[model samples]
Target: MKDEEIIELYFKRNERAIEETDVKYGNYLESIANNILNDDLDVEECLNDTYLKTWDKIPPTRPKVFKAFLAKIARELAFDKYRASRSKKRGNGTMHEILDELEECIPASNGVEQSILGQELENIIADYVRSLPEREAFIFLSRYFYADDITAISKKYGISKNNVSVTLSRLRAKLRTRLVKEGYLAS
Candidate 1:
């Protein structure tokens, strides 16, 4: 079913909205969860949580892109689960590594002022990503947004692992420069 039709189902408070959403976006949501959680059981739980979230949010929130909305919910849930699990066992994973890489570029969230600044920084980064070349943007989002593994990204792009690393390093440097120029980061 199309996104509009599925959204209409939600608006009407029809239970079938969940089923239609699962049919259309289950894998996409699962992939996002899998990237963060890395455990089958955890991924499944996150996906179910995403459906419930979508159901609750749809009545008042009509998203222009349903897939992105679902994916965002799934991603945030997966991150929450990942953080909880890490507090118990700090095992390094793709999500951790990617976040660590971004830690330097993104500003620290101190207080309300920094919170607003963080949102602006996020917008700037999003715009920068959108302005990138197709291949660069794909690789950047895959590694950062989805937290895909370096080896997996290289394999998917049919490129060497070193090349991927170089590309990412350059992109991060460019981002840092842009942030500094925009006064988000101090020189």
Candidate 2:
């Protein structure tokens, strides 16, 4: 089914909307959840929560890109689950590694001012990503947004793993420079 049709089903309050959405995006959403959460049971729980969240969101909010909408929900839920699980016992995981990589460029939300600037920071980062070359942007998003590992990104883009690391390092450096210029980070 097309995205519009599925969205209409959602608007009409039909349960089939969730089914069709699952049919179209289950594997993709599962991959996103799995990337952040390597555990199968957590991934399944996150996916179920994602569908429930989507069902509640779509009535009032019709998304422009349905796939991206679902992806965002799934990612957020997965991150939440990952955080909750880690809070019990601190451990190294994919999400932790991803955040460590981005910790240099992205500031922690520690203060009220920083929290207020969160949306602006997001916009700045989005604009910077938009300005990158296609391959660079793909690599950036694959690692950061999708929480993909270096090996996965390297294979997906047909580049050496070392090259992927180098590209990500350079991208992070450039992002830090941009953030500094934008006053999100002190130079």
Candidate 3:
């Protein structure tokens, strides 16, 4: 079902909303959860949590973008579950793994404090994303923010896996340059 129809079902408090949401976004959600949790059982638990979260949020939320809404909740929940299960020294197998790839261009010591206002951080990141080519920005956010896996991102964007990898490589390079310019990283 389309996101609009699914959202309508959610607002109507129809139980079938969960079933249809699963049928439509289950694999997508699972891929994201698995990327963070790296365990089948935890991924399953995260998916269930996502459904419950959507159910709770739908009545008063009425999201303008349903899929993005579901994804944000799922990603945050999955990451939370991963963090609780592991020590800070043990991070999940996520795009964080690749962050080191750009650390050379922009040293990690210059990181911003997390307590900064969310909108401020989003605006900064939005400006950075806007500096990228449209495809590069989309692919980068799809991988990192959306937590989409390589294969699915390739399929969704109608590009090959290798193409996605190359585009991401270029995007990361550009982002590092931008980060340095924005003073988020050491020169």
Candidate 4:
């Protein structure tokens, strides 16, 4: 089914909206959850939560890009699940590794002022990502946004793992420079 049709289903409060959305985006959403949660059971749970959240959200929010809207929901749910599990076990996971990789480039948020800066920082980063070349942007988003591993990225692009690592390193450096120039980071 087309996205508009699915969205219309949502607006009409038809439960088939969830089924059609699953038919279209189930595997994609599973991959996103798997990347962060890294467990079959957790991924399944996260996806269920994602669908529930989507059902609740779409009545009031008609997304421009349905796939991206589902993806964002899945990612956020996966991250929340990961954080809860991590806090219980205090174990390191893919999400932690991904965040650690970007820790230098992104500033830590503290109080109200920092919370406002966080929103601005998101725009700054989004603009910077948009400015990157297509391949670079894909690699950047794969690593950071999708929380994909270096090997997966390298294999997808048919590049050596070392090359992928190097590309990510340089990209982070450039992002750091951009943040500094924007006065979000002290030079």
Candidate 5:
């Protein structure tokens, strides 16, 4: 079923909306959930939660891009699961590693002013990403947004793992410099 049709079903409050969504996006959503969640059971739970959340959201908020909407929900649910699991047992999970890498460019300090600046910082980061070349943007999103494995990303892009790391390192440095210049980071 097309996204519009599926969305209409949701708007109509039909149960078949869930069925059609599963049929169309199950694997895609599962992959996203699995990336953050280490256990298969956790991934399944997050996917189910994503569907329920989607069912609730679509009536009031019709997404322009169904795939991205589903992905964002799946990713958030997966991250919540990951955080809960990590609180019980530390270590193990690509989400931590990905965030650690990003920590370099992001400012560590926080205050009331920082809270107010958050939206501007997000816009700066978004604009920086938009300025990147297509391949760089894809690699960045694949690694960070999707939480994909480094080895998998290397193979997908036909580049060495070291090359991927180097590219990300360079990008992070550029982002850090830009953030500092924009006063989001200390000099």
Candidate 6:
């Protein structure tokens, strides 16, 4: 269903809005939750929560891009779940491991995870992402943001595995340098 149709359903207070949304964006929303939560159960909970939050917010707030709107909610819920459950500190998954590696290069600031600094971090990261070459940025986000496997990203982008690895390494070095120059790192 088109996003405008979905918004119309929400405005009409039809419960099928959630159903249609899940049908369209379930995998996208699930992947967002999975990136932060690690476990399937936690991810599922966030997926359901995304539906509920979308239902609640639509009357007062109808977003222009449904996918991005849903993704933001899913990401926020997953991050909250991760912090409250402290799964990140445990390093129980590849997402945690990868993020830890990046964190070592550019640590988060203040109580930034729960505040305006989060948006600041987003701006910095987005700028860095946009600065990368097309293939490098595509695979980099596929791995880091979407948590896609290297082979899938390579296949989707029509690149070789070695190219993916090389691009990732170069992107990491470039991001680290940008972070350092932006005073987001010293290490």
Against the true structure, what is each candidate's TM-score?
0.94, 0.97, 0.71, 0.95, 0.91, 0.80
Ranking by TM-score: 2, 4, 1, 5, 6, 3
> What tens digits encode model 1's per-residue C-alpha lDDT throughout 1-187?
8999999999999999999999988988889999998899999999999999999999999999898898889988999999899999997778888889988887788789998777677799999999899999999999988888999999999999999999999999999999999988898
lDDT of model 6 at position 107 = 62
Q: After superposition, how far is residue 151 of candidate 1 from its true place, in Å?
A: 1.4
In order, what lDDT does every prediction score? 0.91, 0.94, 0.79, 0.92, 0.90, 0.81
Cα lDDT tens digits, model 2, 72-150, are 9999899899889989988786788888989998988999999999989989999999999999999999999899999
Of the candidates shown, which would achieve the greatest TM-score relative to the real structure?
Answer: 2
Please tell me which model should have the higher lDDT, number 1 or number 3.
Answer: 1
CA deviation > 4 Å runs, candidate 3: 88-96, 99-113, 146-170, 176-187
Instruction: Tell me how many residue pairs clash in candidate 4.
Output: 0
Report the C-alpha lDDT of model 4 over 1-187, residue by residue, as the tens digit: 9999999999999999999999999999999999898999999999999999999998899999999999999998988888799889976766788888898998888778889888789899999999999999999999988999988999999999999999999999999999999998898
Looking at model 6, which ten-residue stretch has the lowest summed lDDT?
Answer: 105-114
The most accurate candidate by lDDT is 2
Cα lDDT for residue 63, model 5?
99
RMSD of 4: 1.2
Model 2: runs farther than 4 Å from truth?
none
Report the C-alpha lDDT of model 5 over 1-187, residue by residue, as the tens digit.
Answer: 9999999999999999999999999999999888888789999899899999999898999999999999989998988888798889887657889879999999864688878888899799889989999999988889887889889899999999999999999988999999999988887
Instruction: Write the number of the candidate with greater lDDT, choosing between 2 and 3.
Output: 2
Instruction: Specify the poorest-scoring 10-residue window by lDDT in model 3.
Output: 102-111
- Answer with 1 or 4, whichever has the higher TM-score: 4
Model 5 weakest 10-residue run by lDDT: 107-116
